[model samples]
Target: MMLRVTDQTMTMSAQRSLAASQARLAAAQAAASSGQRIGRPSDDPVGAGESLRVRAQIAAASQHQRNIDDGTAWLTTLDSALGSATGFLRQVRDLAVQGGNGSLNQNGRDALATQIDSLRKDLLGAANTRYLGRNIFAGSSDAPAAFTDGAPPTYSGTPGDTVQRRISPEQTVRVDGDGAAVFGTGADSVFGILDAISADLRNGVDPTGRLQALDAAMNRVVAGRVDAGARLSGLQRAGTENMTERNALEQRRSGIEDLDLGKAVLDLQVQQTNYQAALAITAKVLQPSLTDFLR
Candidate 1:
């Protein structure tokens, strides 16, 4: 039996073909205008998923960079306080040496003792240094100062607790120094050491023997500063690594989601031509009859 070809069948087929061509051309135009291959998840599900993952990584890297900046500020403040404390201790040591001189009379010793007391107060001030209203040496404690004022200053910081900042996914750094460890506590503290030297000087007693204690205190301050310097160096290195990671993540995201403008423009032109050709062919194939023209 011979199969009859209907005009209705041909018209439906042509319509479907033209619709597909128009859809492709619209997609190409969107890609060219938006400059993004994956406008939505439906465009490329796998690439969209990968792009989301890369974007999450970029957000985390940005947060870590902020942490690095805050940590650097805290450490910088702590280091500066330690530096000041070291200088104060050095001056105290020099005064102690002068007070130990055999030729120095009572009046001379009294003057040296007064200077030592003044320096002790300055050192106390350094110990109580704050950054953004937070005590940098207080080890996470919300104390107003690292040490309390008294006959022998006591450590106000919480023991075994410290302030820390996460600079990366796997690494964290201590941003606050330990006041008790660096400045000692009670009678064993640098304040107490200064007090003793001042008392010995006022009593006509040589303070050269206490030089050992003063030297030990200065050493602790130096060590604290060294640790701060090391942490600062590590933060600098982490910042560099973070920048490199951000650049790589951006490139990955571009590969997953972004389109090459030149390629997209070319594709749009090709799709436009194909759609125009399809329309011409469909018009020729689906010619209207006299009955259709009357309707």
Candidate 2:
């Protein structure tokens, strides 16, 4: 059976074919220009889903890297403060020993007492050290100073919680140290020890008790430095790991989301050629009017 062909049918068919060709060309051009294989979910559902997941992972890794940077700064500042505290404690300990010497006269002991008094204030200053307007030793307390002035300096800041920073999906690190634990409050503290030593020197009394206290305080400072040093080292290691993971994620995301310009351009050229050929064919195959049919 022969199927009768009509001008209207031919024209309609040509239009549909042209529209489809144009759609293909548009899609190829979009891929070429946007630099992405997956523009919309409809393009390739599975590919688009994979791209979304990879992009999300990239973003998360980038955020974790930022957290690691911030954590590094916090730990650096805290460690520096602890270092200063260690120096101050050591200096005061030496002065206490000199004051305890039997041959030292009252006036000599008084001079040593003056130096020790100055060292105590310096230690207090170290105790109340602030970084970015926040006390380094004050834990999470945002107080300006960690210690207050007195015979035994008072710790006004709370025993704040340790600040932890996320460096990866599965890892977090302690960025802030406990201040109350390092420099104890009031009479039993480093400051208190210094006070007793100064008072004993002025009164011509031996500084044996003060010397013992000073040794214990110095040990505490040493322990604090050790802990801070360990944390700093861990932060360094975490930072290195984060960088490695970030690079890996970037490569993965690029494989899924990034466009292959060379291939896209070739595809675009082929699509353009096909569309042009369709136009030429449609002009010849579709009749413009019934005049052509009668001829």
Candidate 3:
């Protein structure tokens, strides 16, 4: 049997159609105004999840960039200190050569020794260099100075441990150099070597024999500077990579969440037109009066 159609049934159907059309129009207006494809998870659950993931990646990339910057500063400071120490050592080598001269009398030797001692003090200052109130040469040590004041300066840094910074999820870089490795510990330290040479010169003895040791110390400082330079280069590269990754992540997020303003505006206009048409049609269909009901 066919279902009977009544005015009440027709009115209810028209009302439901208009309400659905109004809801679509409201959604289009919201998308246009907000300029986002996914305003809430309910809008597009998969896209929202992807947007969240991309946002998290962007945050991590930002943090990694910060780490790269900090690590660069630390390595730059260390390289500068090592460079200064290398110069000081070179001067010390020259002074040692002058003291080793046979024609140089005791007074001359004493003068050379005094100059060498001054250079040694300068070298010690370089070894104890600090950046941001922390010792660069000291390996994860909280000490104020890397080497203590004494005849033969002692290394105050942690032996095996080093200060490191994580620049990426898979990569970490050591920012601080090993004090003991760069400048030997106890009597074998660069300061100690200088002390021994100074003593030999004051005693009117040849320090040419210790030239090999001085050369070794100079080499160590140079090597440390080279290592710092390498690390700085790596960090610079990582910083660039992190920036690129952030840009890519942002694009991915935009694709997932951001709406095209022009398209959204067009869609809003279309929905508004459709909803108005639906209202007009509904109004015509539901235009029955009480007289018709009485009939």
**What is the TM-score of candidate 1?**
0.92
Which is the better candidate, 1 or 3, if ranked by TM-score? 1
Off by over 4 Å in 3: 1-6, 288-295
C-alpha lDDT (0 to 100) for residue 63 of candidate 2: 90
Off by over 4 Å in 1: none
The per-model lDDT (C-alpha) reads: 0.92, 0.83, 0.91
RMSD of 2: 2.4
- Per lDDT, the best of the predicted structures is 1
Worst 10 residues of 2 by lDDT: 286-295
How would you encode candidate 1's per-residue C-alpha lDDT over 84-151 as one tens digit per residue? 99999999999999998999999999999999999999999999999999888898788788888887
Error of 2 at 158 (Å): 3.0
lDDT of 2 by residue, 187-217 (tens): 7888888888889999999887767777888
RMSD of each: 1.9, 2.4, 2.7
Clashing pairs in 2: none
How many angstroms is residue 242 displaced in model 3 relative to the true structure, after the best TM-score fit? Answer: 2.4
1-295 per-residue lDDT for model 3 (tens digits): 9999998899888888899999999999888888899978998888888888889989999999999999999998998999889999999899998887899899999999999999999998989999899998887788889999898988898888889899999999999988899999999988999999999999989999999999998999899899999999999999999899999988888888889998998999999999999988887778889887787
Q: Please, what is the TM-score per model?
A: 0.92, 0.92, 0.90
